[model samples]
Target: MNKKDSIKACGRTINYEIVYSKKRNKASIVISPDLKVEFRAPHGISSETIRKMVSEKAEWIQKKLEWFEVNRLPDHKKQYCEGEIYLYLGREYPLKIIAFDDVKEPIVSVKDSELNFVVPKKDSEDTLPLLIKKAVWNFYSKRAEEEVEKVLKVYSKKLGIAPPTFKVKHQKRRWGSCSADNVLRINFQLVMAPPEQLEYVVVHELCHVIEKNHSARFWKLVKQMMPDYEEYRKSLKKEGWKYML
Candidate 1:
């Protein structure tokens, strides 16, 4: 079952939806890439309880909404041109294009302080940028999967929860999301941030598998897993530009 509603957070009105699930043991809030807030709760959960939960998380929700509103971009300097800057792990890496005759397909790699793109001189001249873009996307997507797996292993063990299943994808507004089944969807762009930022997002989603809401207990679990999470959270908020596809 599903129903729509609205509430005020940080003196601003926020529209949301409630999705009822008979199999769900706890309630969770998922903010989509379009900034649509959703509440997934058990069939017997009350509207007042959900509303109170939303109200309790008003500040964080408002900040996320505002960040999404401010950070939407159609293009992010991904021209794949020579010397153009790209980020990896919160550091800058300049683009270096190498044209070779034997190269049949685009290949991208990070060597030292540059993102090396190798391409064929004949076939890919017209579609060089697109090829480079795809290569870069694959690069980050693979690294994101690895990073999520590694982080979840260490942190989930500390939190005493088995490593939950996760996926890496491109999302415009969200860093990561925790689904009702304890599955996590991590944004691939997140691999560009510093290591601590990635850990914070992973830990935040992992905590949701237990607490399910942004209540005090959920935050406490996050803190337990990452004692300096607040610093990384604030830094991520300020470095929001680094999280781009």
Candidate 2:
């Protein structure tokens, strides 16, 4: 028989498999689709030991699923209308659609912290919304570059590593990441967050220069730079809806 077999644990039948890896120093239990549990063990670890570990940690695995369900991103089906409030950086602003003449294309302008989008007076609200999205993309792309540079310079000196090139993207699940090749990619959605949170993410990615993985030491480095990062990290979870339009 294959290593994978059905076993009952915690009043539930867990379909699982065992695999060995040379790079793994510890046994890890991964729950796969159809609720199949996989035990990834270090080379030479016994199957019996792996099974015992899985049985013992069944509660923890269930907790992980509970947490995932609780924190899953909400469906983004919010309806947008005229004069709705939106935020960029730390400031709040009302969405204003400025009407134009002569069939001019829509444009966005910022004056004294207020954002205004130019659309023909006769244009449809649908057109205005599309223009606003395009303008937001352009505006945040430039701002993201500037803000990233500001935070990178501070952490690069503290970590004693050269700053790497950065790219701005609209990432789905991550706020930022640093690759092994030293490229730093930041999510443009951060433009919707407050300035302090954005800076925290920057420092978080910059700390990856010293440690690639999310090890304890990596978080220690982040704490050294931003002492209250734990609070900010929780804030990201609590106020996640505010960051979306």
Residue-level lDDT of model 2, residues 116-223, one tens digit each, is 777777877766666678776777777888888988888888888887789988785468888877788998778778878888888888887778877899899999
Candidate 1 has what TM-score? 0.71
* Clash pairs, model 1 backbone: none
Candidate 2 has its poorest 10 consecutive residues by lDDT at 73-82
Q: What's each prediction's TM-score?
A: 0.71, 0.67
Which model scores highest in TM-score?
1
Give all candidates' CA lDDT scores.
0.86, 0.74
Alpha-carbon deviation at 169 in model 2, angstroms: 0.8
For model 1, residues 1-245, the per-residue Cα lDDT tens digits are 79988887688998889988765778888775457898888898778888999898889888888887887545555677789888888888998999999988888888978989888888546687788889899999998899999999998889787999999989865799899999999998988999899989999999989988778998988898899999999999878765665
Lowest summed lDDT window (length 10), candidate 1: 71-80
TM-score of 2: 0.67
Candidate 1 Cα RMSD after full superposition onto the native fold (Å): 6.3
Off by over 4 Å in 1: 1-77
